[model samples]
Target chain A: MDNIAGTKSSLTWAVHISVAALVFLWLFPTLGLFVSSFRTADQIATGGWWKSMFPSQQNLTLRASPASEQKLEGSLYVIEGELFEEGIEVEISRWGASSQNISTYAAGEVGEFRSGETVTVQANGSYRIESETEISGSRGKRIFVTAITPPEFTFENYQNVLFDESNREGMAKAFFNTLTVTIPATVLPILIAAFAAYALAWMDFPGRSLLIAAVVALLVVPLQLALIPLLSLHNDITTFLNGLLGLEGANELKGKGYVGVWFAHIGFGLPLAIYLLRNYMVGLPRDIIENARVDGATDFQIFVKIILPLSFPALASFAIFQFLWTWNDLLVSLVFLIDSTGETTVMTKQIVELLGTRGGNWEILATSAFVSIAVPLLVFFAMQRYLVRGLLAGSVK
Target chain B: MHPAFLGLFTILVGVSVCVGYYYFSNQLLDKVLFPAKGPNAGRNINRREMIRPWLFLMPAIFALGLYLAYPVVKTLLLSLSERLPGGASQFVGFDNYTKLFADEKFWEALQNNMLWLLVVPAACTAFGLLIAQLTDRISWGSIAKSLIFMPMAISFVGAAVIWKLVYDARPIDQDQIGVLNALYLLFGGQEPQTWLTIPLANSFFLMLVLIWIQTGFAMVILSAALRGIPEETIEAAIVDGANPFQVFFKIKMPQIAGTIVVVWTTITIVVLKVFDIVFAMTNGQWQTQVLANYMYFQLFTAGDWGVGSASAMIIMLLVTPILVWNVYNARKEMR
Candidate 1:
């Protein structure tokens, strides 16, 4: 279509450039967080994440070996050692003795201290301090260097966010809790909706189209309306069941927990699930089901053996939608699952708390956010074809 | 119990129960209650057929009824009545609505929502159409499309954090970590502006986050609509000396107008119910309060269920037109 009539479109370059700009504009923010997740706090605070990809000039105040290790080398009491730790690749362009003038002398030049001791600092952060008299102070001499360090990144933020047990804000527990909420929330709706969708699509019952219309209406109903009523209902049910079982004082059953959340998700998810599956099943070849009916197979057996297998694509599509929706949901979990104890907090809630408590701590925020985002993103890129198909089928006529 | 173990256990139990119910109910309908071997086999088969659909539909109808249908009615009643002490309520009859109307924050939220409804859908559809057209003929278009689509997979909280970092501000003397501030300073701005703290413009900044996330959705849908346009029509227009812009505007735009409306209304619904971005980023402070977050604040933080239910009803009211339009379209298509 583009190269029709053997003449290329003159706007091709314009198209390419604009698309490139659009993609860049869209990817930049998420990419910023992704890059910042690997950066140390110092690196993130001192420069933009875009700058972290190249060598950056920094004003670092490092300390040399203390005078306690001073040795008498041929009439000079010398305190000699490296200013930076080993394996650090930094080149000092300038050095100084005081914080007031951090770049007074060039690297490898001698600068005299206020007490008349002379220090020679090299570009690689090794320094030699000498004096005719004994160096007496216990502390090391502070060496301020304007150094250029190569690009550096670390996995330590992820370690602290995900693996460190003593870190009170760690996401490990919340990660598992989210998985707990998401898996059942994703799987249960498919089974329930699949059976119902088959009935709606194929079964010739009265009020079938009306039921389909009702499902479509429920599709757009805001779940916000469900919060207060359903929450009170959950509480009432818990109280009633606790009393009925003689477990009132024990309080063995609470309103907010995994089972309650799973039910909520299943209820909220079913409309879309049934809508998508019914739409797909209606399009299934008519002859196959009719032939199976002629062969004396029951509708249940037909659905299980033939329709279920044939509707795999629609099933997979709806599964991905429900999985992503349940995984990335915050409101449902907050309302139905988390209690006052906060023991069952999911990753989204944890990250929101981190935002309030550690607002400026980009390292922790970025890492925790990415941890929550990584699963859906993996599923998205892997199963994007089915997702797009589902969207087209579900939304467009 | 460990959550992971409990999750696995729940899945096993839930799936088996559902499968068991479906299996046993069908068996009961076919064999026990209406056996084919019975003398009245014909009537028995008809009775079984009549009951089987309800058997399959029972769980879904139960869930949808309890979770969705009942809540609308319940929320409406709760909104209309004031709760008294000791688990009782009194009929207040529009008192909550009058109080909500008197509040400045409610009006502010309604105004901001109006602004969102106008801006988010327009921006998303325009950008989506632009990108869909731009990426239609390129070789690497799919990769570009997917990358643009990537943010849709991100949770609103994750997007809030991502955009929060993008809008971060620092003192003027220090290096700016946020790209927006960096660019602002580089362009000779005197001071770093806290972008999210600015009043009305800050709402736009928040809308930008949603726009960023949703444009991919519009693009995918519109791109499909664009592809569905007949090539012969485009070629015919080209042979008739329509320039690229002329061809697109005159020939193509008219064909996919319906899809553009579909994308617009869909995004409009999303923007109306947007909560997490405002909830996570600014928590509806500095006059950035939208309706959904405002309702959350009224309900949870203020513990005023009356006002909260009132606000929820307002949201449902705003969505009512789209709801009707969607159901109407579904019925029309069926006919």
Candidate 2:
């Protein structure tokens, strides 16, 4: 078969080439964000992220040594110092003393400034200025240089987004808020749905098939319909219960916080969880359950001891799905959790706010977005086996 | 209370309650309500079996009904009534629907959603099939497939930021920072065009983000289907002198047609509910409104619950056919 057609080799090459191309096309967007997150605001705005890997030529405004550092050398007052900070990888390609002609002279060349000072700037940003007369200015001379700096990346953006205490828009609280929303929202649904799935799968009841059909139908019900009605219902129930019990903070407890959001996620996530787990459970071997039954174990014991343990793959798959969905959810949190106090804002909402206020601030936007995405990406790649298995099971029935 | 501690406490409470309820309910049903050692033991066990399923199903049914089912009906009712202050409402049948029908933004959203429905699914499916077929025979196909599938992990807002950088534009006579505009400049374009400001084309640009994320899903499913196309059929076609293209379109594709429909419908559902991308990227500005964003704008910003519920009903209306189709398929499969 291999020898039948030499054209197969060329076809194989084409396959390899096309796959590589497609992979690059897919990875480019994510890679752009990943690369830009480490960059400074100046770097990100001056050039595209793809160009961040190379030495970037930039017009820099730097100050020379002030008059205090000027030494009397022979008859002239001279100032000698390096323009760039220590250990910075910068090559002064072109240098000038004025804004109009910033690249007036090449590296290692000397020119006369407007003050009649002869200046020489070397490629490594070392410069010497010799004045004909006494230099009396208190401020240092301004030197504009067009330099090719080595590709630079900084953690300052991440620091500002995550750890800056004074920054009102920091993602620290939102990160914790997202964690609070996600953990219970993820855990409760699996706990609740696993039981129902077992009943639908193993236990016999009337309308079992119909229940399965309903779960499948509920899978695509848009959450948009749930927003207004649920909000009103929640508010009314909270207020009535508060008045009934004569409690002070019942309204605060029930109004757009963690518990309400937890319930919202559990409810919204139940359909897919049940659907996935039931599909997986129905495929489990009947012999195990029958053996447990014959041994006089009750349905609860069988579910807890035998079915739950054996359904790990399915359970793990659904847990990952629910976790990612709950973590990434914005509309749900916006409607159900975030009150006027804004204390319950999640990372998605935080990023949206940043998109509005700091639209041009890629440093903040990129870092905040990366922070939000990093956790799910870790969960995704770490448990990709279960994730893919879940996708295959959930969709390709 | 600190949120972290509250989180830990809630997990404990939630798990314990769920586990405790199932354990206790089952025990009560067996040991108290239907004692197996009674004189009518056989009948008691039979009765217990009939009741056990409902006990197991109670929590799930309650949650789903409260969260999903009731909302569907409540939304329908709310669509017909206008909300008054202080937890009261007056029935105003057909008023909300009439107002919604008259609004131009709703029409724009509907039209744009139609466009999204058409483009996103088709592009995702086609690219998915192309990648699937190409990668099926390659040695490094799995790696390529995973790379493409990686976008599924990203949130739509994160993806918006990623693509906002790509669609970024700069004024003429300045160095372009966005890759799209940079390429445009490099390839002899006159001025830097704001890719997201252009009305009709901007919607397509946003659709590209979803298409990029979803094609991997389509590929994963379609690739599995392609592999399942029995080896005998492909070998037989090749031996009969059908070329590669003919073998694909004439033989292999027809077998995977059912899967193609499934992928298309799945992505179509996703496209119909597309909100976060449009919200984060443009917020439906410059004629880019979709139903979900428009509904959000109505409900929250404009404070019009009646019209908001109507738009939500429209979304539900769009989803009804798919819901029926999915249920029909499930029932058919069960039979």
Top TM-score prediction, candidate number: 1
After superposition, the stretches of candidate 2 with alpha carbons farther than 4 Å from their true spots are: A1-8, A249-252
lDDT tens digits, residue span A113-193, model 2: 888898999999999999878876889899999998888889998888888988677699999999999999999999899
| Poorest stretch of ten by lDDT in candidate 1 chain A | A1-10
Cα lDDT tens digits, model 2, B251-332, are 9899999999889989989998899999999999999999999999999999999999999999999999989999999889
Distance (Å) between predicted and true CA of A75, model 2? 3.4
How do the residues A266-356 of candidate 1 rate in per-residue lDDT, one tens digit apiece?
9999999999999999999999999999999999999999999999999999999999888889999999999999989999999999999
Q: Using lDDT as the measure, which candidate wins?
A: 1
TM match of model 2 to true structure: 0.96
List A-chain TM-scores for all predictions.
0.95, 0.94
Q: Residue B211 of candidate 2: its Cα lDDT? A: 96
lDDT of 1 at B272: 85
For model 2, the TM-score of its B chain against the native B chain is 0.99
TM-score of chain B of each: 0.99, 0.99
